[model samples]
Target: MAERQGIGEPRFERERQDDAQASISWLPRRLDADAAEPKLRRFGAERFEPARLSLWAMAIGRDPERPLAWLLAADHLPRALLIAGALDPRPRQDEEALVLDGGRQPTQAQFERWWLWERLARPKRWSLRVQPATLRAVALPLWLGYSRGRSGAGQERKTRLIVLSGLSGEALGALKPAVLAGLRERTKAQTDAFRSGVPEGTPEPG
Candidate 1:
């Protein structure tokens, strides 16, 4: 008998930094650091961290040439958010500094099953096909705010995270689960590598 493979296996590239940065599209950030700081302050966050999430875009329905596109979070836990129309991502400009990219790349099969079909319930009205060549990966900007607060007097203060959209500076409560899952996975990987001894060329965790 053959062994069974998990559907969520990390078969795709682990982290495509240089290649993705060069080729992949990026959603423009309308809120700069100066403008975002005040927004974070309102949430009582002492400091903020900038990050990026990799999203998968594909045209679904009967026509592969449809103008509208679907955007999938494509992280550890996939979430689907439908864009109104076609994807028109802007290139990262020179002034934009690099940020940590969270989320794993999903295989075409996994993307279709987990992110698309599962959510849409395999609508019979539309003819959906996964065209590997048509799949495009884009980066979405995010802001993570760190705030310290105490449950009650005499209790130790604990830090909390607030996620916001770097594009519109709006709170991203729905994406909290995906963000937390990605952070936990990254932490576990670093911890395991540390226990096994860090490699010479391996970069230190920031």
Candidate 2:
């Protein structure tokens, strides 16, 4: 049986994507006892819970030592707004150019559907920052304080995931560093993979 202590960060090294995936045939492995586990001192809302943490633990727990290859076919999308350097650079309407040319993207709604997509993005688009070492995820926006960690002008963004695991203050303090380190390493590898497409089966970290 796994130890009852907090989780620990698994050993990890970088490897090619295909080789990594080849090692993991089915699901991501559960974490080993060596992995650091943070204590949960408090609760924010009802959504973040041990179940969520367990899910996260299960997802990357596989081969904690191998480098992480984040599959981002749908992640880190640019905002629909035409902000200068925001998510997407396209104009508010996806068809400004097309309309100018008297045409549009092949759609049945005459571009209304595309417009609707852009409309809905604003409310749901909560920018999130990936926590390192601990393998925990955090939202970056202050408005999202309720769901993610609370952050404002002066506050450093900490994780709001402690409640999920029901850890105490001491456990939270102890687990902070481990979680940050793991998350940072994971995020770094993921960012690298996002920049360059990895092979199908990259090895996962322990």
Best by TM-score: 1
lDDT of candidate 2 at residue 205, scale 0 to 100? 53
lDDT per residue for candidate 2 within 20-117, as digits (tens), equals 22232212212211221321222343232221111111111124343222111101112111111111111122211100010111112212333345
Please report how far candidate 2 places residue 15 from its true position, in Å: 21
- CA shift of 18, model 2, Å: 23
Per-candidate alpha-carbon RMSD to the true structure: 7.1, 23.3
Per-residue lDDT over 1-206 for candidate 1, one digit per residue giving the tens place of the 0 to 100 score: 01123556455432332344346787777778898899989999999877776665555544566634564555554455555455667776554443444455555666566445544664652455544445666777888889997678888888888888877788877677767776776688778879679767878779
Instruction: TM-score each candidate.
Output: 0.61, 0.24
lDDT of 1 at 191: 89
Output the lDDT of residue 133, model 2. Answer: 32
Model 1 misses residue 130 by how many Å?
Answer: 7.4
Compared with the true structure, the alpha-carbon lDDT of candidate 2 equals 0.25
